[model samples]
Target: MQRDFCDPLGYMGTRGGDVTATMAIVPRIQQVRDCAAAAGLTIIHTREGHRPDLSDLPENKRLKTARAGAEIGSRGPLGRLLLEPRPGEIVIDKPGTGAFYGTDLHHVLATSGIQNLVLVGVTTGVCVTSTAREASDRGLNVLVISDCCAEPDPLEHEMAIRLLQIEGGYIATIASTVDFVASVNTLAQS
Candidate 1:
């Protein structure tokens, strides 16, 4: 977790690398996906990248990026980070940092009767924080597993946690991968 991938040197204004847009939670994302499968919890993914045609992104966001062409459907290194969801898993292509912004994700969660959103992904200060706040605003219970997210700035990451614990909708629950896995396994046995 202490590698350059987990370090701040990677995420923010830096550019041009295989990991520029790769999911920081790739390993844990896979673990969460599998655990959700065993626990009968629906696994959903929110993608932040836009299409290659730039049809999906607004002009303002594109203008601010180091490379204007780094959306999901493009041929850039960032575009290659998205993993295809499983057959039944849902993927919401979001135009913004927050998953619920300008998307029917809340509707889908309600339709599935998902009262709890156990969130996991990249950029703790940006995407993860935004998603958690939005989920709280929408009346969903948000449990953010600390080990499953990464941020460019360590201070930002800590600030994100503090903000979530203090003002985020519900009290944000933190857990390690080992603890989470063990809890899931216990549930399975019960």
Candidate 2:
């Protein structure tokens, strides 16, 4: 999770939104990450950010974030708001809400022969959902772990999962962190 979204005095906090729910999902996400790593599954991280000159930011999105106190390119306690590629992790920087748009994510997936996608991130209704939808559209089987994602508003977080399921369950399969971890562990043992 980016500091801008998770850190108090950062984006969400500056706009008076409680950061409790967002922070609460961190452990579950880490649990998922560990299981996926042990299973030898690829873990790709997606980050939303604009260029230094804000050239890639759309007018509406810029206005929205500015009003909410997350000025593009602004640094938080965790340093820059975007992302840095960690060793052995693929980091995709996205200009828009979804990761695939204007990014090589699709190409990377195809080249790497990845078919199923598991998503875990902050703001379930936004970047995470957007990425799930995009991946589904591209024929990737998507699974979003319920407890591993959070929104500032819990209702939206819950609703986003339902919305994805309403499309005949083609959008994404929603799971809990416990179930996902068990499945991954079983696969690892096999």
Candidate 3:
């Protein structure tokens, strides 16, 4: 999780947004990421950011960020508006909420033969759910780790996950960090 979204001294927290629940999922996300890496699964990270000049940011989003006192592309505690990915990590910088919206995500997935996607990110009702829906619409099997995602409002997060579970699993398949890791281990051994 980026400092802007989860850090108490960062954007969301400084603006009176509660980030306690979001910060709590970091460890769970790490566990899931490690399990996937050990299993040799493709790991792609997405970060919300705009160009340094803010040319690519939409007007509505730009206004919102300005209101929050964390305008996109401006410097933050994480070096930039978004946290930089480590070397060798496949990170996709997204201008919008959905990762595949304006990025080469589909090409990357197609080239890598990635028919399934494991998603873990913040703001369950927003970014996380957007990516999940995008993946589902693109014919990718989506699994959202319940314990590995967070939103400022606990009730909204719960409702978002519940909505995805409706229609007999139409959108995404939900799992816990423990269950996801176990499944990865089982697949690795098979």
Q: Going through the candidates in order, what is the number of backbone clashes in each? A: 0, 0, 0
Could you tell me every candidate's TM-score relative to the true structure? 0.78, 0.91, 0.93
Candidate number that wins on TM-score, 2 or 3: 3
Candidate 3 matches the true fold with a TM-score of 0.93
Q: Between 1 and 2, whose lDDT is larger?
A: 2
Runs off by more than 4 Å, candidate 3: 78-86
Top candidate, metric TM-score: 3
Local error of candidate 2 at 12, Å?
Answer: 0.6
Across residues 1-190, which tens digit of lDDT does each residue of candidate 2 receive? 7766776767777777788888888878877887887788898988776667878878888788667666575655566442344579888879987889988999999999999999988888988899999999999999999888888889998898889888578899989999998887887778
TM-score of 2: 0.91
lDDT of 2: 0.83
Candidate 1: regions farther than 4 A off: 1-25, 51-56, 66-75, 167-171
Task: Give the root-mean-square deviation of each candidate in angstroms.
Answer: 4.5, 2.0, 1.8
